[model samples]
Target: MKLLAVDDARARILAEIAALPAETVPLARSIGRVLAEDVAAVRDQPPFAASAMDGWAVRSADCPGSLKIVGESAAGHGFEGRVGAGEAVRIFTGAAVPAGCDAIVIQEDATREGETVLVPAIAAGRSVRPAAGDFKAGAVLLTRGTRIDPWRLSLAASAGRAEVSVGGRARVALLSTGEEIVQAPATPGPFQIYDSGSPALAEMVESWGGTAVRARPVRDELDAVIAALRDADAELIVTVGGASVGDHDLVRAAAVVLGLSLRVESVNVRPGKPTFFGVLGDGRRLLGLPGNPASAFVCAEMFLKPILSAYQGAPTAPATMPARLAEALPANGSREHWMRAKLTYADGGVSVRPYRDQDSSLISVFAASDALMRRMPGAQAAEAGTVVEVLPLSRA
Candidate 1:
C-alpha cells in the first residue's frame, strides 16, 4: 500500500462523513452545540425608546429651565401622559421615555424643588437608548453551523428563543485490541500491561463534542476482534492498536472479513505511519490508530479531531497558529514530524520549544506537552528566532 500524505488522508476521511441530523434542544442546554438553523430576533431589543440612566425625561427645548414634574416612569411601568412643554417626567434607568420627550437630563444635572426641577441644557437623544438599539425584529442573530457559547447563548436568549435547533452529537465507539494488555484494577501477568489508550481517547472524544462509547479490551484473536467490531453501535468506530502488520495485529484482517473498503492504508508521518481509515460493510467509518501512546495521541489530533468536527457540522480544519521558535532545531527528515513542545507567552508574542525526547511510547512527554510544533518533510534547520506553525492541545 502506498503511503498517503496527512492532508490527503484527512480529506478522504472527511469526504465519507456528513453532519448529523438536527435536533431541537433547550436554549440553556445548547452551549457547545453547533447551530443547525438561523435564529432570528422575535421582537426588537428594548422594544421601545428607553432611558439609559436614572434621570428626568424632558423635551430638549424645555431643559436648562425650571419645569413642573408631571409623573414618574419606573421599569415595567410607563408614564401614560406625554411630556408637555415646561414639564418633566421622573424616569429611572431602563424606563421607557414618556411620549413627546426627546432627551433625558440626568438627576445629577438637575435640582428638585417641591415638584419643580431646574435642569441643564441637554441635546436631543441624549441618554436615551433608541428602540431596536441592539437588534431589530426578524433580524438573523445566529447563523447555522455556529457553535454556541455563553455569549452566543445570551444573544439567543435575548432574541426570545427558548429552544434552538442544533446538530446532533456524533456517537463514537472506541475499541482497544491487544493480547498482552489488561484493564486497570486487575493484576496483569508478568508479560501483560494495563490498557491506557482507550480511556484517554474516550475523554478526548467527549471533549471534542462527541459521545464516546467504550468497549472492553479485546484479545488479539481474529474472531474476538471481529465480534467486537460487529457489536459496536455507533456511526464511527475508532480502533486503538493492532493496525500494523505484526502477527498479533488482527484488526485489519477482521475488518477485511467484515467487508472493509480501505480509503487510507497508511500515512507518511513520523510516529504515526501505520494509521489507517476505511468504511465497513455496514456503512460505518473506522479509524485505526497506532498502539504507542504518543503516536495515538498525535494522530487523534491530526485526523480524529477533524473527523469529529465534520460530523458535527463545525469547521473541519485544525487551528494552527504561528509562533517563534525558542530553541534551534535540526533539519527534518523525509517524513513530516509533529514534535510535542511547551508554549511560552511573553512580550506580546508566543514562543515554542520542542522537548529533547520524542519517543512514541513516552506518555509523560505527551502529558507535559501543550503544543505540537510542525516540521515539513525535508525542511531546513530552523534558528532560534524562526517563526513556525503550531497546533494547540485543548487540554493544555
Candidate 2:
C-alpha cells in the first residue's frame, strides 16, 4: 500500500468529522468550552453614565469654586435629583453619574465643609464613564467557535449572559492492547511492563477538551480486541498498539471484522508510519497508534489533537512556529521526521535542541522534550542556527 503523507492523512481523517451538537452550560462552568452561538449584550454596559472613581460629580464650569454638596450616589443607587448650578454630587466608583454633572473632583482635590465643598478645576468627563462605553446593547461580544477562558467568561457575564451555548464535549474511548503490558500498581511478569502510555493519552484527551474513557488493557487476542471495540461507546475510539503489520498486530484485523472502512491506511512519518484512521460501521471513528511511547505521543500531537479540535469547532491545525536550531543535524530520510526537542528563549528568539537519542520507545527522552522539530522528507543536512519549524507541546 502507498504510504500517505502526514498532511494528506490528517486531511482525510478530518474530512469525515464534524463539530458535535451544541448544549447550554452555565457561564461559570463554560471555561475551555467552544461557543456554539454568538453572545450578544443584553443591555448597554454600565447602563448609565457612571462614576469611574470615588469623587465629587460637578459641572466643569463650576469647578475651582466652592459649591453646595448634593445628595450622594452609591452603586445600585442613584441620586434622584439632578445637580444644579453651584452644586456637586458625592459619588462612588461604579455609581451612576448624576444628571447635569459633567466632571468629577476627587476627594483629595477638594475640601468639604459641611454642605459646602471647595473643588479644583477639572476637565469635563475626566472620571465619568459613559453609558455603552464598553459595549452597546445587542452587540455581539463573543462569537461562535470561540474558546471560553476566564477573561471571556467575564465578558459574557458583563453581557448579562448567565448561560452560554457551547459545543458538546467529544467522548473518546482509549483502548490499550498488548499481552506484554499490565496496569500499574500490579506486579508485572518478567516479560511484561506497566502500561504508561494510556494514562498520559487520557490526560492529553482531557486537556484537548475531550472526555476520555479508558478501557482496561486488552490482550493481543483478536476476540478480546473485537469485544473491546464493540463495547466502546464513544464518538472516537483510540487504540494504542497493534497498528503495525506484524503477526502480533491484531487491531486492524479486528477492526476489519467489525466493518471498518479505512480513510488513512498509513502515514509517511518517522516513528508513526503505522498510524491509521478509519470509520467503523456504527459511525464511530477509530485511530490506530503505534505502541512505542514516543511514537504514540508524536502521532497524538499530530493527529489526535486536531481531531479533538475539529470536534469542538476549533482550529484543526497544529500551531507550528519557526525557531533556530541549537545543533547541527544530518540529512533526513524519505519519511518526515518529528524529533523530540528542548526549546529555549533568549535574545528575543527561540532556540531548539533535538535530543541525540531519537528512539521511539524512549519514554524518558519524550518526557524531557518540550517541542518537536520537523524535518521534511529528503531534507538536506542543516547546520547549527538553521531555522526550523517546531510544534510546542502544551503539557510541557
Candidate 3:
C-alpha cells in the first residue's frame, strides 16, 4: 500500500478493531475497567424517611411548644409508634423517622423536662432526609462504556452492586527483531545495542490496562521471526523495528511469507513514517513500529493505545487543549510533525516549546518533554504566541 495519511490510517484501524467480549468481575476488581452493561440501583438510597442529625422527630405543627417524649429511635433501630399530636420521638442521625413525623427538631434547640421536651422554632422538612432522595430503585447508576474509577466505584457500591459486567482486557505480545538488538539484561558488544523499545511497549500495554503476554527478542531470521509471530496467546501482536524497507528489515518479509497481509504500509507522520499495520489469519491485530526509540513512542501513542482502548470499550478520548507557542516554528514539510515539547503554565493558558534535539533516537529529549504539539502537514509557519492544539503525553 502507498503511504496513508495519519487520520485515514487511524480511521481504518478503528473501523477494523473488534471489541472484546464481556466478563463478570467483583466490584472490588472493577476499577479502571469499562462497564459492558448498564448497572441499576438495587434499592433506594436512605431506604426510608430518616433523620439527618441527633434530634426529635415530631409533627411539623408541634414546634415552638412542649411535647411528650415517646420511644427513642437510633441508627438501625426505628420507633414503631406514630407521632401523634403533641408527641415527639427521640431520634439519632440515620434513624428512620416515625410515622406522621414530617420534620426533626435539632437536639440543641430542645430541652428535656422529664417526660416532656421543650421545642423551639422548627420548620417543616428541616433535618429530614426522604427516601430515594439521592437515587431511586431501578435507576440506572452506571451506563455501558463507562470507565470505572474511585468515585464511580463508590457510587456503584452505594447503588448495591456486588458484581458488574466489564469488558475483557486485551492480551498483547511484544516482539523486537533485529541483528544488532540485544536483550537489556545482557551486556551488548561494541557493534550491538540493547533493545529498549520492546520493554517500553510492554509497559505501555500494561499501563493501558492490557496484559502483556510475551516480550520476545529475535535476530534477523525469517523462520524464527515467523515462529515468534505465531504466538497464539496474544490478541494483538506489536513488533518494534524490522519494519522499514531496508534489506535487514525482515519483519514485513516474514509476515508476507506467513500470509499476514499488510493493511497499512506507511503513514505520513514524523518519527513514525516507517510504521506498518497488518492482520494475522486468526483475526489478531499486527502493528509494526519503527525501531527508533522516539519513533516507537510516537506510533504507540498514535495507534496502539487507541486500538487497545477500543477493545476495552473506553468511553473517552485523549485530552487536547489550545496552547500558545513559546517560540516560532518553521512550516511543516510533507509529514505531520508531533514536536516533543515542555508545557509552561501561563496566566491565560499553557504554552509549549519544542525540544532542540528531536532526533528519533533521542530518548533524553523524549523524557524531558511533557506534550506533543501537533503540526499538520504543510502547515504555514507561526510566530511565538500562536495558539496550537496540543496533546499531553502524560495522559497518553
Show where candidate 1 strays beyond 4 Å: 54-58, 65-81, 86-93, 104-118, 179-196, 345-348, 364-368
lDDT of 1 by residue, 1-396 (tens): 779988898999999989898889999888777888999999999899999999899999986899999999999999998889999999999999999999999999999999999999999999999999999999999999888888999999999999999887889999999987788999999999888888899988887768899999989899999999999999999999999999999899999999999999999898799999999999999999999878999999999988887888874777899999999999999888999999999999999999999999899999999999899989999999999999988763
Tell me the deviation in Å of residue 204 in model 3.
3.2
Per-prediction backbone clash count: 0, 0, 0
**What's the C-alpha lDDT at position 299 in model 3?**
83
- Could you say which candidate leads in TM-score? 2
Error of 1 at 275 (Å): 1.3
Query: Residue 201 in model 2: shift from native, Å?
Result: 2.1
Error of 1 at 153 (Å): 2.5
> What C-alpha lDDT do the candidate models reach, one value each?
0.92, 0.92, 0.86
TM-score of 1: 0.86
Arranged by TM-score with the best first, the candidates are: 2, 1, 3
Which wins on TM-score, candidate 2 or candidate 3?
Answer: 2
**Which is the leading candidate under lDDT?**
2
Give lDDT: candidate 3, residue 90.
Answer: 95
- Model 3 TM-score is 0.81
Ranking by lDDT: 2, 1, 3
